[model samples]
Target: MSLPKVRSTTVLGVFHNGEVALGADGQASMGNTIAKSNVKKIRKLQDGKIVTGFAGSTADAFTLLEKFEEKLGAYAHNMKRAAIELAKDWRKDRYLHKLEAMMVVANKSELLIISGTGDVLEPDMGIAAIGSGSMYAQAAATALKKHAPHLSAEEIVREGLNIAADICVFTNHNLIVEKPV
Candidate 1:
């Protein structure tokens, strides 16, 4: 008998005010069995200018991040254009097409979400999330936005992380957070 593989999920949230937050459970499990804990799924890229939250195969996520960062570096003056190009490349990249990973990236001016659909998407709601805990995080963010007026971007991210942590054992308080100047 063969066992099914288990994948880890990371949750990320960004607010309109340029504040970003991300969380990943410390637990990695394989079919109801714990595999590894303390694995980090959130990463800071482009000299701390971009925050990435990823879900799916760790290797695939890292590969995407590296490629995106290189592209962003080439077009440092125009981040929006760089993002669009990267998204397009991601969709067409043969390796990326084969992997199962989704990413949510937050920069100073834009929040973009990239899923396996091979399309780069920007949400009208000024926020994007990826990973298994994303649904829970998104719900928490919506509630926070409705009930907590004037909350800072960081505050919203904190709230989102808290929500994710509650449901996922792989997530904890030690979340990797970064902000652009």
Candidate 2:
């Protein structure tokens, strides 16, 4: 059998009411076992102007985040430019090309999902999610956005992630949420 690799799952980002919030569950899994809990997968980048959530192999995700930050700096903090540049490099760079990770990044007005396959997508519905529990969290966020108009972006992310944690065995309740301020 192959050795187990630790990976993180369940990340959600919601843009609502002129605010953007990104969140992620804290469970890291190794094959069928939980390797760690309370691993923060959300961060504020560009000196708090952008919020980011990551999912996939823990070390690979960190590597991607660091590369993304470098792109942000090189691009003068333009999130779109940075994300696209990161995705471009992630796809072509021999080293980065081997990484397995995805990221949801946002500023107050824009939300984007970046993948190693050179995709930098802006969710038309103002929500983006990645990792194993993404679909569950995405569905939950969609319903909440439609029916619970009063909920803030962070609220939607929290509730949606919680719902995902309930449904996805790889996900958990320990969450880290961040918003650009």
Candidate 3:
């Protein structure tokens, strides 16, 4: 059986002035049809200290999320280490290597992207985005960080999402924002 490729959302993460925040749109598309409008792509994990956002098949993303959480616990809640470990496993493990999802995992102190190809990335400018509208959102956040450094982390990401939603039909302005408390 062949699985459909799902690219229906946008997720953005930003780290600024010692704070971290993530925002994701609420749109899920199935082929040429809109499947759902309020689907949440960002999630809080490890008692809300850790944040994760995903783009791809929802079911596959959830599977990766569960594995990533296990890695977190094994690595003692160290976000970076857990991300790296997950990437390693995702690329090397037969079953995991086939999972179709990309993830951004972050905390108040760090931001990283875990990919199925065994890549774990930390954005130099403290911003990262994924999914179909990722480029638009990333560019917006990068500009905000460079030109308007006074904006809070939440504001930067929210504005980024807004911009992405405007240009990317798969994305929307209905954003869920989360920050470290």
Give the whole-model CA lDDT for all candidates, comma-separated: 0.68, 0.93, 0.90
**What TM-score quantifies how close candidate 1 is to the native fold?**
0.83
Error of 2 at 123 (Å): 0.6
lDDT of each residue in 62-127, candidate 2, tens digit only: 999999999998999899999999999999999999998899999989999999999999997899
Candidate 2 CA-lDDT value: 0.93
Each candidate's number of clashing pairs is: 6, 0, 0
TM-score of each: 0.83, 0.97, 0.95
Determine which window of 10 residues in candidate 3 has minimal summed lDDT.
1-10
Give the candidates in order of TM-score, highest first: 2, 3, 1
**Lowest summed lDDT over 10 consecutive residues: which window, candidate 1?**
16-25
- Tell me each candidate's RMSD, in Å, in order: 2.5, 0.9, 1.4
Where is the poorest 10-residue window by lDDT in model 2? Answer: 1-10
lDDT of 2 at 153: 95
Runs in model 3 lying further than 4 Å from the true structure: 1-5
Superior by lDDT: candidate 1 or candidate 3? 3
- Score candidate 2 by TM-score against the native: 0.97
lDDT of 3 by residue, 141-171 (tens): 9999999999999999999999999999889
